[model samples]
Each structure stands twice: as C-alpha cells, then as structure tokens.
Target chain A: MKHLLSINDLGADGINEVCRLADLFTEVSQRPIPKVPALRGKTVAMLFYEDSTRTRLSFEVAARRLSADVMGFSVSSSSVNKGESVRDTVNTISAMGPDALVVRHRSAGVPHQVTGWTSAGVINAGDGWHEHPTQALLDCYTIRDRLGSVAGRRIVILGDIKHSRVARSCVMAFTSLGAKVTLVAPPTLLPPAVDSWPVDVSFSLDAVLSDCDVVYGLRVQHERQAEALLPSLREYTAQWGLTVDRAARLPVGALVMHPGPVNRGVEIAPEVLDQPNATLNEQVRHGVAVRMAVLYLLLAADPDLHPEGEAS
Target chain B: MSTVIKGGLVIDQTGERTADVVVDDGRIVAVGTDLSGDEILDASGCVVAPGFVDLHAHLRQPGAEEAETIETGSWAAIRGGFSAVVAMPNTNPPIDCAAVVQEVLALGAKAPCDVYTSGAITVERKGAQLAPMAEMAELGVRLFTDDGNGVQEAGLMRRAMEYAAGLGVILAQHCEVDSLAAGGHMHEGEWSSRLGIPGVPAEAEELMVMRDIALSRFTGAPVHFQHLSTRGSIAMVRAARQAGVAVTAEAATHHFTLTDEDCASYDPVFKVNPPLRPADDRDAVREGLADGAVDAIATDHAPHTMDAKERPFDQAPPGMLGLETALALALTELNLPVAEVVGLLSWRPAAIAGLKGVHGGPIVPDAPANLCVFDPQETWTVDPHDTASRSRNNPYAERTVRGRVRHTIVGGQTVLVDQVMRP
Candidate 1:
C-alpha cells in the first residue's frame, strides 16, 4: 500500500480495487467540468525530472481536477541544477506540507525514497527506467475500458525497452490486473534478467503480434542512438519498426498505441498513430482520469486525511 | 592464511581423487591422505575442486554503487564458489581507458575473489569507434568487449578482432545486432504474440553471432560469445567450432534453467537481455553444456538497484546477479558429471580468462589454493533477501534447488564456510 514498487506487493484484491477505481474515475471524466472535490484543499506536488509532456501535465491536471493544490517541480531549473542532491530536494519539498506527492525522476527509486523524506502518500509518476505506476494504471484503464475485463487477455509492449519506463510499469500493472504481458525488444534493449518479474518474454516481434489484442509501441529516443543502442535508425525501422505491413499481421482486433512524440519512421509508422484503433490520443484522455483515480485513492480515499471524518 | 580442506573428493579437469589438501600462506602446501595445517576446516562429503572462475560479471561501481560494487560482487562470487571473475567494462565511465581498469582492479584487491577485468572494445560502447584495448590489454586485461553492445558495424568489429588478435586478447561479444533486435523486448515467439509484447527475433542475436563468427574467421581472432541464450546462436557456435574458427562461448545459468514461459508471469525478474529463449532453446543450452559447445557457465552477474529492476519488464535494467548462486544453479540445471560441471565452473573458464596460471585447479601441491568445498548432493532454495550484493535482483528465490557450495576459499582465504559469507 505504501510504494507499489512491485506487482507482487499488490494482490488480486488490490488490483481489482485499482481497476474498479480507475473505471469510476473514467466515468467521472465523462461529466461536464470533469472535476472532483475529493482532494480539495490538499496539496499534491509534481516532481518531473525527465522529458515528459503527457505524464507531467496529466498529474498536474488530475490534481487540479480533484481540487487539490498542485506544485510542479522542474529538475533543470530547481536547486537540482545548482548541485542539490535528491535527498535535499525531497527534504526541501517536504517542508511545504504537501498532502500527497507525485514524483517523476530519472532514477528508478526516487519515488520509493520519498517515503523517507515525507509522510505524504507517494504516487510514482515515473522513475528512471523504473515504474511509471500511473501510466501502467492508465494503460490498464484503457485496456479494461474497451474490453470487459483483463483476467485472461494478452498484452504486448513494443520498442525502446532498454530505456522505456512506461513498458516496465505497464507490465507490472497489466500482470497485476491478470493480463499476461510479453515484452518484445531487441536484445540490446532487453536487460539480462527478468527472473524477478512475473511476465513472459520474447525476442521476435512476430511471435506475439498475432496473439496480442493490445499492442503498445514506444518512442525510440534519438539521443540513445548516439550511444549506439542500435546500429542505424534506418536498420532499426526496417527490421523492428512497426509498419503497415507488420500491423496487418496482428490479430484482427488488436488495438495499437504509442506513448507519443512519434518518430514518423522509427518504432511505428506514422499512419498507425492516426489509425482509428490506435488510441494514441485516447491514451492522453485516460491518463488524466487514471491520475485522478490515483490521487483520490492515495490522498482522499482514507479518512485519516480528514481526521474529523468530514466527507466521503 | 593457513588452512586445510579435509575429507573431500578433489575433482578437477584432470580427474577426481580422495584427498586432504593443505594450504599455507595462500598456496597449496600439500595434498595427501592426511594433511595438517594451522587451521582445520571440515570438508567431509564435499568436493574439493579449484575455486570457480566466472567469465562475465558487471560490477557497477563508482557511478552505480547502489546496484553493486567490486566488494559486494566478489562476496557473491565467493558464496557462489568462484575464486575469480572477469569484471565487464560497461560501467559509468566505461573501462575504455587504463585508469578506469586500474580503479576496478584496485577496488578488487581486497575483495574476496581475484577480479580480472575486460576493457571495452568500443569507446563508451558506441559501436562506431574502438576503445583503448591495447593499453588495457597491457595492464593484463585478457578480454575486450563493449559487452552491453556488440560492435554493430562489421568493419569496426573486424578491426577490433584484428587488434584483439594481435594483442592475444579474446573479444567477448554480447552478440546482438541492432537491426534485428531493436524495439523488441522479449524473444520473438508465440509466447510474445500472446502477451502483446514486441518480440526480438532470434536472428537479432544470431545475426551478430554469425557476423562475429565470420569476423573471427576473417581476422583469425578468438571471440567469446557472452550469454548465448538462443538455440540458433548455440547451433551456429557449435558449427563454427566444428569448422575450427577459434571460438568459445559461455552460457548463463538463467538460459538453461528458465524459458520464455517464465515471462508469461509478467514479472520483471525474468526480463533479461537475450531474453529467455523458448524451451527448445533452453534444452539446446543444456545440450550445449553437455556436448562441450558452451565452454563455461558464466553468471552474467548484472545487478540493478531494486527500483531499476522493480519496474515493468520492458523498463528494468536487463540483468540479474548470479555470482552468489551460480555454482548451485549450474549443478542443479545441467545434467552432467559433477567433475564435468566443475570444469565448466572452474578450470575451463579459468583457461578462457587466462587465469589458468593460478585460479582454476587440479588441486595439486604448489597450486594457488583458490578452491571451493561443496556438498554436490545438498539441496536448498534460493533466497534473494540473504544475498551479499547491494542489489537483490535474484529471480531464483524460493525455488528449490539441489547442489550448493558449502565452502569457498579464494587464494587460501575462507571467504565462505557453511554457506555463509565470512565478510
């Protein structure tokens, strides 16, 4: 309940509860004004340390929608740039009396470390190549929203895996929701161990493409190219990149998705991003709802926040 | 520094014999029916073989201390029954220069195991340029690799092989080409299809293995393939060896013990580079071990902090620490003569790492006394929570395993006894 660092920490009931709450939040997003007073008057801080437009803004938007005061922490402009350590930044922010904290860092455990800094319920927005719990939750909401339940379905995450925090988090969330997850990435992208995670893994994209009902594609950061995680952009697009030809090989109804900032020629073709079933934009919409659910659950769901037991 | 291993079957490449070996001042003083020393250690019903030698290990020190350090990795090495291990060069500064290599070597000076290191083949593992291999080689680095990445460019790799051959150093490859492997997270197969995860074809790894084999042929260099998980890669390596291409390959214990089906659980613990291959490949890895296709059982001991490894399968760092449990897992997973298995764990890899002068053994008098005493028949389950490494990324926890190292002695020092790390 403290830090959702691992899916094993979340059991069947916990997953079902999160999924149920996500559904309820999705319904609330359908209403006009799209706001909730559950976390009204509370402060939720957003600490974003990496390149993220969607996850960063959505947590802010979600906290705002829940009527919780929001503070956006930028790494480059803060004391972090002026030689501040993670512990120092966290302690400095803890003094602000935030009721809940939304942290996204380049290192994987920073959010888990926030617990040592403050008592405010921590929501891992994203950690470096670690879990982006909200993204996984949103992706789960997207899958369960379209499909009735995720108990036995198959989900495949594609691309830039050596560097994608979303894929890591999604697998944790999906597996918890009881959907089987297969991670498909080049060996260069794949790490040397998965014994800790409870997921199926593979190397060939075609192995799981046809069976996957939900396909998540990731962006290939060009900066990683400078590091030679790949040989050439042209080569990667040709072999591993998702093209129209490759998409047609999927199960007839497999939905497509990309985390965004699309590379027209790299991981996925441009047309796939625009495809009706892509859900690339819909993912953005669901992202906010999922964040709202997370904020509500962590900040307002417990009566301890309102020691007076004022409101539901 | 004086101790005696009494009442054990001394097994090594030469053969197995019942003996008591005495070690004094970091060297084996005597091996006979009754050997006495300043200290007496119980080795009854255990195999007294040369200490295990690991060909692959990633000690993420200096920059990534939160994951693993030389001291911790060495502690793991001793617990897993290894006396020496070759530290990979993919650290923060990257072991491309002589200074960084020295730093790692110096750090390992007081470690439980003798830590030999490999220098990067490509500077920063960029795959475009070459690293200062000759200089590092001059420092007695016997292996060279941009191990986290194979030199993607054939020309660069060919040149590296040429240079490596001239220096008499082995080029160890991660053996994955970007074109075939990029964007894929797991092994490309039916399991991947069912899971909706993008798949990386066996060719992603195979193609590189194939390319390197050809490069070895072209340059007449010896290349070591690190963590051969795919059947195709093993088959090719087998064929290349039969063709006399001067090559050797090491398979990780995870490859033989686990399959892609383990990934079906959607756990990050099974998320590894050269992702777990299919069952057939797992079988092939075992066969490769039995048939001598794989020269050694390397741990590929890569450690990542819990958060780095706690993420989803696709985002976690691709490695698990094996130094602490490799020997037990190897014996349990591979169906082979214990002596043969010890060869894979010890002398075979010692020869490969060029530490045969001291590390791996025949348990003879005047040997370096780097040794392990283990009850080959004992059974136990792995528990990550008890590991000596800074990171607890072990996927083997709670799984019952037979064959455990009861004691590990590195250079006559008792680093492990009764399966406990002395340090």
Candidate 2:
C-alpha cells in the first residue's frame, strides 16, 4: 500500500485512490501554467542504473511540474559505472536528502533493496524482468479514464507477458480494480507462474479476444528470451499476434493498447496499434499527468518534510 | 603426530629437488632422506610439491544447493590434487559486502581444502556499478571480479583498478562485453556457422581483456585475466607481461584440450561463457602455458543442475565441472615435464593469486602442511559419473587420461587419502 512495487502490494482501496488522484492530476495538467505547490521544495531523485528515455524523462517532468526539487542521476555518466556499489551510491544519494527516490535497474529487487538502505521513499521504475509498478499505474489510470472505471470490463493482455514487468504490475492493479483479466500467450511466452496468478489464463489469443473490452499488448523482447523458449519471430507473431483482423474479432467496442516501443507487427498488428479505438497514444499523455500526481502524493506526505530544507 | 612423504622428486617454480618430506603437527618439519615419522606414504614414482591451486571454481551454496556446495567442491578439489582453490563470488546472494564474504568463509571452514573466495566487484553481478572493494579486501578477499560479466564501461574499470591498486588487491575480469555477446549461444565461428547456433565472437572476450590490460597499465593495478580463450587474448597478455605491466593470466584446462568442434553435436555440456574457441586458439592456450605466457591452469569449474543444463544447447547455461579432472587432463594432454606441469598447477598459480605464503611451499620446516601426493604416470579415464560435485554436467566424462590423485593435506589435515574423500 505504501510503495507500489507490485499490484499484489495494492488492495482495492489503493487502486481507487491512485485512480482518483490521477484523474484530478490530469484535469489540473490541462489548466494554464500547470504547476502544483503540493510538494513544494520536496526533492525527487530519479536514479536510473539502466538505460531509458521515457520512464526517466516522464518522472523528471512530473516531479518538476509538482514544484518539487529534482536530482537526476544517470548511470551512464555517473560514478556508478565506475565499480561503485549500488548500496554505496544509493546511500550517498540518500545523504543528499531527497524526499523520494525513483530507481530503475537491470536486476530484479534492486529497488526493493534500495528502499531498505535509505529513509527516502522508493518507487520501482522497472527492475529486470520484475515489476515496473508505475507503468501499471498510468496504464490503469488511462483505462479507468476511458471506461468510467474498468470494474466489470473483460481485459485481455496479449503478447510477451512472460518477460514484461508491466504485465505483472498491470495484472495486479486491474484484478484488484475488479476487472477480469485473461492473459493470452503462446504458452512459450507465459512464465511458469502465470497459471498461478489470480487471473484467467489462455494459450490461444483467439479464445479470449471475443469477450475482452481492452486488448493490452506487450513487446516481444526477442533479445532477452532464452532461444529455446520460442522458435522464429515470424512463427511467434503468427500464433499470438493481435492483428487488425484479430482486433475486429474481439467483442464490439473493444480497445487495443500497448505500452510503447512496439516491435511493429511482431506482437500487435501495426494497424491495430494505431486504431482510433486503441488507447496507446492516450496512455502516453496520461503517463506524465498520472506520474505528476504520484510524485506529489509521495513527496508531500507531511508539512515538516518541506522544500527549503531539501535544495541545500 | 608426524607423517613422512617418502621419495618424491619435488618440482616447483622455485626449483626441483628429491626429498623425503616430514610433517609434524600439520607443518612440513623436514625435507631430507631418512626422515622419521609416525606414518609413511610411498611416493617413489611421483612428483610432490605444494598443493595445486585452482584460480576458478564455483562452490554454489547459500543459493543453488543442487549444483555444488563448499564441502563437496572441496572434496572435488582434493581428489584432483588441488590443496586450495579460489571460489567465484556469484551465488544466490553474491559475495559483495563483507557479510556475504564472511558467510562464504564460514561455510568453507570445514571443507576438505583451503577455500578462499573472490568478492564480487559489482553488487549482485550487475555490472552497472562496482561493489565495495576496500571493505571486502579488509576481510581478506585478495581478488575481486564480476566474473559473469566484465564491467562494460572503460571508465568504470579504470576507477575499479585505481581503487584495487590503492588496496593492493587484484582485479580479475570475466572478459565479456554485454552488447557484443548478446543473444549468443556459442562461439561465433565455423562450428557455430555450420550448426546454425547463434555465436558470440572471440572479440567479445578479447576486447574486454585488452581494455583491462590497458586499465591495469593506467592504474598500476595488477589485473588477473580469467580463462583467456582467444589467441589474441593470450598474445595481448604475453605482450603486457613482457612490457613489465602488472598482469597475470590463466587458462582453463578446457581451453587447452577442447575446441568449438565439440559444439557441433548441440550438446549443452560444451556450452560455456567465453565459449569454446577454435583448435588454433586451444593450441595457443597450451603454448601459452608452456612458454609461461599463461601463468596457471585454472579450472573455471562451473556447475549447474541437471534440469537446468539438460535443456536445449542454446537455452542451457554455460559451464562444465572442472575440479575433479583438471590435473589429469593437463598431465596427459600437455605432455610437459612433470615438474613444469606442477609449476603451472601449483606454484605459479599460488604466486599469481598472492597465496604463496601459505599454499605453495618448498616442503621445508615450519611451513603450513598444505600438500598433495599424486602418481605422475598413472593412467586413468575421466568419468563425470564418478565426480564428487553435486551436478551431472561435466562434458569430459569417459575420456581417457593419465595421472591421478593419491592423497591431499591442508593445514595438516588429511582431507583426501588413497583417493578416498575424508573430512
């Protein structure tokens, strides 16, 4: 409930609160001179030990618009790559007195460990093939925004869910939000633990496509999967794809969405990803706003935890 | 109690001598003819020196219990005539901080041979950062490395070397660049091409070794290159050492005996990091050992569970068990003089690992009773089925070779005797 490391950590109330905050934050973002003093002077530091463009910049822009001081730490240019231990760097960065720290890493549980090493609140911004909790947050917020809350909607997540941190987090959030989630994969792309998750599981995308209101697609990280897991790319796409034809076969008024960096026509059909009914682009817009609300709620926890004490 | 090792010609890096060594209270008390002792072992047709030292071996405990443990790995070490071996730091919980290092040491306390562990240079082997070298070194971890990965950035490596130089601990590298080695399942060469298996180029390893040597030269830190496989890598190490730069090199026994040709069968057993190179490179590793360009013959003994390693060759993890079969293969395959082979196995590695003070010795009085007795000319066949390691992934099973272990002593403890494992 305190740190959204995974949806399994959030209960029903937690999803509602984040969704409510996201809606208010998005409305405020549309106002002229969108800035909030809710977390004035509190600092948020994004410490990405892995490479990123969207996640890093979104958090950066979100914190800035909240009038919170920011310290952006990048692994590529920083002393971290110089054999500096993650604990040492996180400890030292914590010494600078940031109110909240966002961490991204290539290894799972890095952020989980960083939270233990510092007093600063921690957010998991993608760690290995683990949870990217906030990506799930924005995604949930975007779905709720369109469907007036997705409590009764049937959602089907397609593509490489086994390797997706977002899929893991999204499943936790959506299921807790009262939505029915059916995970569709080609069996080779589903984790061994997939059947154990609190969601309906199916190997054939066609089996679930008919009844789903939201068709969420995942990227096929061809580079990361063990070669023996799946055969050729063309073969994987043919069996588990969300092509436009497949999209049309879904229940009427269904939407197709992807958490970007699409392997065009590989996981989701290109035409389906760009369809007006799909909410992929809307998700990106809602991302920065929902992140802004999260930054505020996390950093402005108390009055005494003020900004003037932070920047120095 | 006193024990006498009778009639073995001792060949060590120091020199060759024929002597009867006497041990009392676990220390080598005398080395001469007509030595008196409470127990005596005949060693007439063998060579005796300090115990062999392995620069690389994985004692996978505190995490992957199904593969290996400190106790079983030590038994394997002694049965192969190694009185000591360095344990790699990648485990369930890595040996990064002092706590993990201390834990590994505690686990190694009752093992058959002396077990010293390398501390991870990067926390959790995520090469995005370096681990605490000074703290780990303070706990007596003399070497540091992210053995599964080389620090990708040259700047990170330079800084690590500078810190390592300041602490006087050596830095060992796995010699791989992530970008270059990505998605590769085997060595990128003719065999891989023919088999259609995705390949990792030899450059992926050589490039990192070359960088580490340059970093060592820049920081004046002694860098130890682990399992040098490429001909280019051996050439670089030879040049660097010749130039008086502080660097030492080791080659795994597989590098000397095996080739990429083995991967043709799509056997997961042959898959390993710094993947098997061609025959020419294998010959270079042998020549490097013969010419002293490569200072030691390390095992790079990696172990994996049956289910984990028995998967498709491209999907299975890299590494093969090495501790139980390294010496016999070196003895039979290299065809070097017994004394010189001992140098590569025992003394030279001891010196390189900075363990000479306690491990490699002259079998003289007042020294640690760390020793091994082996029959130099005994013929044997490698049988993975007979190994003491917990896993069944050794690729060298059922191969014929010569020479075998007779007994091993560590700090005066008879951990292995007459080829039988002892406590």
Candidate 3:
C-alpha cells in the first residue's frame, strides 16, 4: 500500500496484514526499550492543517517508537498562517525528503491532493468529515484483539456521523472485516445519504444497543446544538449517550469503544467509562501500534520482499 | 476588410444550406455558391454557423485579473466560437452601477469579441437594496443579476423584478438559498455521504428556483434562472413556463455533462455552483436542453488560478473554466443534431443575452458577420494548459471531445483562423 489515505484503500487483505503487523508492534511497544530499528533511516512528516493534539502526538509517538524521524508542521506555527497556499506548503515540506506525509486538514481531500504534489506516501490522519484511516485501523485492531476476529461481530457507531471522520472510516473498516455494522444517530446528525451506506441506520440508539458487540461513540460537539442539528446537549445525552442504564443493559462480553477526546457527559456518560469492557484507552494504546504498522508498510517493510514468515 | 468563408454547410436558426458567406465592412455582403472576396477563410468540411453568445461568463476584470481579464476572456470566447459574451458582475467592486457597467463596456470595446456587462440586481450583489438599474439599463445592460448569489429576500427579489420589468430588463438569478447551501462543498448525495464532505442538498437550489418562479409569476416580470442543475428545478421551470410565466432557464455545460460522482476524486475542478448533481439530474438537464425547457446552454465560465484550485476540495473555491470547452463538450456528450446544438450555443443564448439582432444569425445580406466555422467531426483532446484564460481550471482537461472550431469571425473580423488565434 503506497498510501493509507482511506480504509477503503486498505481492503480486507490489506487491513488484515496491517492488523497482523500491529500485533508485532504491540509486543514491541510492551518491551522495556519499547522501540524498533525497523524504520531508522526513514522520515515521516506530519502536516496538521487542523488543530489536533492526540492524533498528532499519536503519530509522532508511533514514528518515534519505530525509530523513524518525525517532522511536524502545525497550521498555527507554520507559514500557512501567512497565507501560504496548500501547494506551496506541501512543496516546502516535500523538499525535505520525507518517506511519507501524515496529513490532517479541515478539508476532506487535502491528503489526496498532497499525493499529486509530492512523491511521499500520504496517510490521512483525519480530513474534514472524511476518513481517519489510522483511527479506523486502531479501532479494528482493538476489536480484533478482544474478539479473536471481527467477523460477524455487531458494531454500532453512534453520534454526529455526518461530521465525524472516525464514524465514516470505522464503518467501512468494520463492515469490510465481516462485521455487521449499524449506524445510530439522529436523522439531523446523520449524513444526508445515510441510507446508501452499507450499514443499517437507526435513529434511536436504544434499538441497536442489545445486539451490539461493540458500541463506538463519536464525540458530539456543542456547536451542533447551535447549528440546530440537535435541540441541546442535554437532550442528545438523554437520547444517544452511552448512559449507565444503557451500559448495564448491554449483553455479556459486549465492549464499548470511543475514538477520543471523549465528551464525557455527552456521547458517553462519565460513569460508563468506568465499565470493565470500555476500550477507550485500549483504542488509544492500539493507535500507536497500528500507525507504526502503517508507517512500516508505507515506508519500511516491502510486503513482496518480506512476505509472511519473513516479515518478523 | 473583405473575406469569404468558403465551402461549408452554413447553419443558423433559419436552418442549413451549402453557402459561401462573403463579408465586408462588418456585414454579410452575400451568401452564394461561388462567393469571392479579398481574402478567403478556408472552411472546407466545416459548418459555418452563427457565433455563440454566452449569457453567463465571469470576465474577472476590475478584480481577480490573475484568473481572467477582458482581453484574455474575450480571446477565449472567440476561440470557443462565441461572437459575444455577457460578463457576469461578481467582480471586485462589482458592476452594480452605471459606472462599472460603462467601464466594462469600454474595456470590451477593445476586445476581439463584443463583451456586454450584466448589472447586479442588488448593490454590491449583497441582496439588500436595489442597484441603480435605470442608469445601468441606459448603458445597454439589459440583463440584471446577482450571479454569485441569489437575491436572498423574496420581497427584495420581487421588488427587484418589478423594478427590472419597469426598466425593460431581465433578472437572472443564481438560484441557491444561502441558508440551505451553507457549509456545503458539493451536492448532497450518496457520493457526499461516502466522501464525508458536507453536502448542499438539491433543495438548496430548487427552493430558490421555486421562489423566483413564483416571484416572476407574481411580479409579471421575466426571470432567468442561471445554471439550473436539479431535476426538480427543471420541472418547476418547465411547469412555470407552460403556465405562461415569463421564466427562462439555462443549464451550464458541466451540469448536463458531468455528475456529482466525479467528485469522488475530491478534485475541486468538478466543484461548481449548483454543484454537479446525480446522474438523474444530469439526465434531466440533458432532457431539458433536448426540449425547450432549458432555453440556452450557458457556460457559467468561471476561472480560478491553479493556486486557488489546488487547495483541498472543501477549502478550494468552486468553479471550472467553461468558455474554452463548452461547445465541444455539448457536441460530444449531448445526442442532439448539429443545428440544435448550434441553436443552443448561439441563437437561443443570443436571444437571452439581448444580442439577437447583432449576433445570432440568418446568414442574410446586410446582417452582422458574426460567424463560426467548425468541423463537427474533428476529435481533439482537451489540454487545460492550452487555454486563452489566465487560469487553468478546465475540468475537461485530457477529455477527448468531438468538434473543433476552425475559424471565428466577430463583426467581419476573423479573430481565430485554422484553430489558432489571429494576431
């Protein structure tokens, strides 16, 4: 895979390969040294045009753990604030000879556009309501690690699916891995053509709660309330939040997952995070390993050269 | 100067005939079998037709010259077989008044093709108060519009239409309800849901179209809808026209030829106003043009620099360069006869742009010699870099399209000959 721009870019086989590589990286991350010489000579550039803390740090940590150099350019600190065009900024970073560019922008297709301007393999960290492939990969790895395999698992993604890149990518990743995915959100918060999405959609989160093996909650912004997509945060929390009542009603061995910075009282009740099966932290932990695997795939390990048993 | 357009099938609203058109002193001197003149423009195996008129073109002069200017846009117009083009007034310090209108006309006076200016219906195109329509109309600004924006207020639009009717002018609307269209980068559809970009629902355009048609019916004034892209909008316009309301609509070239599915690449070139819709809407637009529901094929010929277009799909400004490719795309994509296509490109739009007498032709004696000679069978791939406009945002780049304009004569002047611009 030259780029991990979308989960769709990594089909079933590609996704499984990443998950397998992530297993090895997870083991390395647990080591005392917690580092690998796999990508020592390569450099990964982080081009975060949007304000991101966890995603940027997660990628930086992932690259560093694999011993790859990390170069970061946040929008606020860069020449982009001075009216530099995306092309110019990309060209400036591209001149530095990075093996891959991890791009996160407020626009849906910046990373795709960046690929045309540079030779580097482009990874979408997150783009506006588009795919956050790494987040989806990490979510996939988390599910696979817990459930043996994702096949036939019932996954429910709920929240502002319209504005959440996590929801978009996770739906594709989970469904492609043979999981039965259902999207739960208010009609206003759901994407316009949600019916066309592979997943079955329900307005009430409660309807799909019992059948779900994994319930993924996206962060609900307060601004969506002001935009009239929701009446208020309190109403959203009452309807869709993974409240204590909803958490207690889940079937045995069912897991809770969220791509964080969680809205503790909105999409998920503060008490629900205390549940033993809540995999929020594990999602973040798997993030590094999954991203490391991605970097390895795009920059270091040639699958054809070191296929199967030889990859270790 | 005298010239003879030799050996071509001449087509116009008056129909087709094998004629050699002889031009002298800015008028068609004669049309006969063996016409001779001081010079001959070889039109062998070509159709000599009336030069097209663009009811909507953004000659981004007085502002945004980095994208296009009167000189450059005019060159593109004549190259695309256009004898005249109505410059849309969405510029920096817009053509909202007589001064800007006169300025555009003065600049157009020197251009290769006749460039007419459309006055903004609202001052600064802000959709607030009415622009000085009386002064603007006096300067030959027959079409009034807020091209980049619809007059958002129904009352304001009704007043503007009533006012425009009094001045003997037409109000052209770029039909988009801002509230519905807010934060939308592309059409709201399955592709938008998959791509995760914010969608502008088809209702956003249709609602305003519906409103304007009602307003036109109420005000008894002529309303022209610009670049109608949706099936619902076309149906409403057709219904309204049938009901005897003075409503005329034009479809942009992209709307009929390309669909929202093209936005899957997330390329901003496909991002245009009244954003390309689904295949259903594209088919509806084609059907509208095939019948008389859609009056003209206007190239909402917007231009943007590569720097602007290279931005991310949502961040990038919406528009594609249309002036250079509209004719070829129409001929290649639409399953219409050569005469019908010519009518859509030329006379129909000419009547809408108020350039009927001077531009759209009958190939009769003492008629203005605005003509285009094009080989409809010639197939050529589009090269975005090979544009007359300063910017290169042509979505049809690398697309192999049939029909090539061989020569363009504007007012007895051969501005383009043998597929090359004249000095």
- Cand. 1 Cα-lDDT: 0.81
Question: Best to worst by TM-score, what's the order?
Answer: 3, 1, 2
User: Candidate 3 on B274-296: residue-level lDDT in tens?
Assistant: 89999999999999999899999
Residue-wise C-alpha lDDT for candidate 3, range A1-312, written one tens digit per residue: 788889988787778888988999999999999998999999999998888888899999999998999998978888989999988998999999999999998889888888899999999999989999889989989999998889899999889899999988998998898999988988998888777888998889888899889998999999997899999999999999999999988999999999888888888988889888999889888988998889888888565424667432
Per-residue lDDT tens digits of candidate 1, residues B1-423? 578889999998888889999988888889989878777889898899899999999888758988889998888888888899899888999989999998998998988889999899988889878888888988999998888787889998888888888888998999888877876677877666434355688888898899889888878889999999888899999999999999999999899998888776556677788888889999999999999998999999999887666554565668777887787787888878899989999999999899876988878888888999989899887889988889988988898887878888877788888988887
Q: Which residue window of length 10 is worst by lDDT in model 2 chain A?
A: A303-312
RMSD from true fold, candidate 2: 18.3
Q: Over the stretch B37-110, how does candidate 2's per-residue lDDT look in tens digits?
A: 88887788877778999999999877888899998888889988888889998888988899988988998887
lDDT for position A270 in model 1: 81
C-alpha lDDT (0 to 100) for residue A267 of candidate 3: 89
Q: In order, how many clashes per candidate?
A: 63, 3, 0
lDDT of each: 0.81, 0.81, 0.91
What DockQ does each prediction reach against the true complex? 0.05, 0.01, 0.86
Q: Estimate each model's TM-score.
A: 0.65, 0.59, 0.98
Q: Interface RMSD value for candidate 2, one decimal? A: 15.3
Question: What's the lDDT for candidate 2?
Answer: 0.81
Task: Choose the strongest candidate by TM-score.
Answer: 3
For residue B384, give model 2's deviation from the true position in Å.
Answer: 1.2
